[model samples]
Target: MRASAKIFWILGVFFLIVAIAYGFVTGTYEPHGIETVGFPAILALSGLGFMIAMALTLAYRKNSINPSDDLDAEVSREAGVQGSFSPYSWAPLWASLGAALCFLGVAAGWWIFAFGIMFAIYGVLSWVLEFSIGQHAH
Candidate 1:
């Protein structure tokens, strides 16, 4: 988790730099009412950085040491199942596709947005109950 946190922090900084560069390139020399690209990029990048800072702060409050982070830890200490993920699930793909459609529908039509909402709902529900109410139940 510490490694992940560091990676996100680096990404956050990189994004912040990119956003600043982008704003400069977009001719934001003086304050304006709004910008099509620069303002949103700055907001999103700063928000992402803030989110990572908050998440890392919260996680560190737990005070748990990661075996992987400990240089002196034994190799055997890391030899265990780490986390579980649904390998055979297609729900994520569907959900992402539905989300993409929803975004696209913003310029397309309300009908497309409605369909995307239904698709997203179905995908999310299937993902949640895939193991609880199916052959995969354990």
Candidate 2:
């Protein structure tokens, strides 16, 4: 995580520099229009956002160090039950179907949109409470 944060930070700085240089060059040719510098500006802003987010994560997680940060850390030391994860579930399929229906509704009619909304709600609720019922209850 530390390494990743550092990389993002560097990228952010690099993109910022590129954006500045691009703006300068483009400004010389076209003083009125922003079309030329928009892409680089977007890149610069995205990089800055990513860098700020990572910096915040590092600041917030002051004590939690990633295993990879330690040279002497062994694989076994890092290996453990990460968290609860569903091996298989129909939620994703339902959600996808709902999304498809919603898109179709946009081209079809409002009734289809209402159906999609209901289906999407069902998918989300079922996924959230999947383990609260049946054989997977806990």
Candidate 3:
């Protein structure tokens, strides 16, 4: 995990540097539209986000109890307490239907990004509702 974090950080820094360079190049030149350079900036920010994810993973790995340790059983019990739902319930159906609707919206030209937002929201809602219902029914 530490190694992965380091790699992510390195990639993030490289991407950030590239993004900065892109800004400079675009700022100095007028060969093409500014929007053409926006993608590189977006890519850089995405790399930075990946770095953040890696950092969080490293932190979690550091704090989590080892499976071979005496605290393993207790840790597992607590983990289970954090989720009392079965994903095998109606969650899959709802999520799949939501995904299909989102896809159709995107295909129909409702806006590509809007479809992504709707899909994400639907995913979260479906998970929450399924978890709640699954736990209660259990």
Best by lDDT: 1
How many clashes in each structure? Answer: 0, 0, 0
Query: Model 3 misses residue 82 by how many Å?
Result: 13
Tens-place lDDT digits, model 2, residues 27-115: 77776744555856667686776768688567648967778777888898778888997767888788778888899999999899889
Question: Native-vs-model 3 lDDT?
Answer: 0.63
Model 3 C-alpha lDDT per residue in residues 21-131, reported as the tens digit of each score: 777777678566454658566676867767686775668577754333343355454453544546456655656666777687767766754665566676768677663
What C-alpha lDDT do the candidate models reach, one value each?
0.78, 0.76, 0.63
Candidate 2 residue runs with Cα over 4 Å from true position: 14-32, 35-52, 107-111
Q: Estimate candidate 2's alpha-carbon lDDT, on a 0 to 1 scale.
A: 0.76
The per-residue C-alpha lDDT of model 3 at residue 32 equals 66
Ten residues in a row with the worst lDDT in model 1? 26-35
Candidate 1 lDDT, tens digit per residue, 102-123? 9878889988988888889988
In order of appearance, the predictions have TM-scores of 0.66, 0.64, 0.52
Candidate 3 Cα errors over 4 Å, as ranges: 31-33, 36-47, 50-54, 57-87, 106-123, 135-138
